[model samples]
Target: MDRHSYMSFYNIFDKNLLEKERTRSFVLLNIGDALKNHEIEVYYQPQVDARTGKLCGAEGLARWNSPKAGLMMPGKFIPVLEAANLTYKLDICIIRQIARDFRKCIEEGTPIVPVSFNFSRTDFETCNPYEELQKAVKEYNLEPKMFRVEITESTLMSDPAKIKEQMTLFRKAGYEVLMDDFGSAYSSLATLRDFDFDEIKIDMGFMRNFSDKSKKIIRPMIMLAQSLDVHTLTEGVETAEQLSFLQQAGCERIQGYYFSKPIPYSEFVQKLKTMDCCDDLKDCEK
Candidate 1:
């Protein structure tokens, strides 16, 4: 290629990259505005007992309701937020929403099962998670047990000392700490020993090929958690067969579309009410 032609092509490529960066910056700035104006929302997905199929708890997930873009899933916006260094802000917003919702449920006489929220690695590195959480709980007059914190195994690997300190702080504040996406990382067992997590959630990938061979690995992991007196929960369970296998393998809790998908706050409250009524009726029949 001629020198002038190569220079022209390089200039065009650089201009395109610059334009993309500007677009990303603009979108992230708008997301910050959405957070301030309460366009982002917290949704809950229920978790149930593997043996009894009763409502045990829920996991709090984030959603963005953009007026321009309609509803957006976390996958759509979380990376943008992280890249923009705004995850700590988003995490605080989620915690505040969960606290407010828990308060509202209590006032209306609804059952308040524990709800868990995910914390990014940046959350630990940049902020005082313990004090931030304590302030949120105090603002709502809620107990610590009403909330659980989920940290991914990979996140824990980022800085073991800091993560351990944060985990210790969480437990000291009366919140249960759960290791999420356990098998997805290389050092799952190492974290299990080095940290004081109350529970370990097995990654859902194992269920894709949940044959005897898979069980040979999973069953032992569950048993190891049991041996340490840490509870076990499995996510992404979608069928009776999968649920049955996890149950037989001694998984303590399960969450997935097999029971229900993540729903809005109002629908989740209604479902909880319906489940409570059904349990009452079953007791009457007995």
Candidate 2:
């Protein structure tokens, strides 16, 4: 067979195989019902100021627990939902849940620091996506600044003009914008130029290293953001040494196990209680 005929045969076989793999149909199995049924839970990871031990913010990571699937992370099914044209519904579900959780935190007398959520490029292209955000905030009586939305460099650089416009609207609405996983892509600086980000999150790879080369890679990004008056957040900071490096480099915040790992809502509340009690003990010692 010729090259063209062989390529056509391969394409047909590949399509058939992929369609068969999707036959289990996880996406079509009433994901909305699962969310409504309270099968989904949002996990909170705290972000702390490096200079002070105070909690500056938190990031919301989604998890799902179904009677059928037991437990799963967003990476397992979010892409499937997106491929099935159900991402908008999934996004709405997540936002509404986050709003409800924010209200709960407020009621408990914990200061409601901003919590960040990831948003895909497809979400921005949806008609009146900002309106959906507005309604959620209004309904929950949540301040727009009480939440941050994180976007990755890959999405922002794909269409600079459009992402810039959408992001400006987010800023005007009092939502903090964070460029997540910075330095992971070549388009990082381009995206930074195209939009006004309130914060930039350092990619974890450099966080795993404290070598001279790694310091060289990280310090420039922090300096660049500081010059623009944007806060820099470092992720995957699991050791005191890493936290010290980030502080020396002038990173605005450090997140990860040098502080504490992401915990269940109940556990997080308990953690706050323990910290408060420790403060009282320190005061008594003083």
Candidate 3:
């Protein structure tokens, strides 16, 4: 290759790399501002008691209403936030939003159910999550029992001692801790024996298969949780057959599209009202 041609190629490659880094930097700068400006929203997906089919609670999932990118799911921004060392900031924002919504529900006479929020491993490593959560609950006049914390199996595997310390703090503060996406990591069985989690959330992948082979694996897992006297929940259940199988397998709780998708606070409030009315009607009929 000619010297001039090589120089031109190098210049083009460097320019492309610089442009990519600039774009990433821009997105990282905007995440914090987005939280401050109310562009980040918390959507709630309802969980139901499998045996009674009654609404039990909801999980708080974060969504970004980016001015530039439109509505973005967590999958798009969470990793970026974690990489930028801003996961705890986003976690605090979600907790504040949940507190505000929970207070509103109480004022409106809607039944207040516990809502679980996810915490990244970065959160535990970077800050005191238990103290932050305690402050938020106290500021919003919320009982600690009104909130739950979900940590994935991979998160537990990241640093078991630190994670367990945080989990112990959460328990002491009256918050129930859930081991989320169980069976998705190598230490699932070991973590169960080690941590005192209030519930275990089976990963959605099991529901995706739901074959005879999957059943052999899933049934025993649920039974294991039951045997330990811990509650079991399965996510991503989207069909009657899957729901039936989970219920029969002794799963105590479920959260997935089979019940309803993660919805905005307004719609979730309406759902709460509707469920309350239905329950009242059934009581009257009885």
lDDT of 3 by residue, 257-285 (tens): 99999999999888877763223212211
Question: Best by lDDT, which number?
Answer: 3
Provide TM-scores for the models: 0.88, 0.84, 0.89
Better of 2 and 3 by TM-score: 3
- Report every candidate's CA lDDT: 0.84, 0.77, 0.86
lDDT tens per residue, model 2, 100-198: 877786667654556788876667666455678788999987788777888888768757778778788989988888999999998788778867899
Which wins on lDDT, candidate 2 or candidate 3? 3
- TM-score of predicted model 1? 0.88
Shift in Å, residue 163, candidate 2: 2.3
Model 2 accuracy (lDDT, Cα): 0.77
Q: Is candidate 1 or candidate 2 better by lDDT?
A: 1
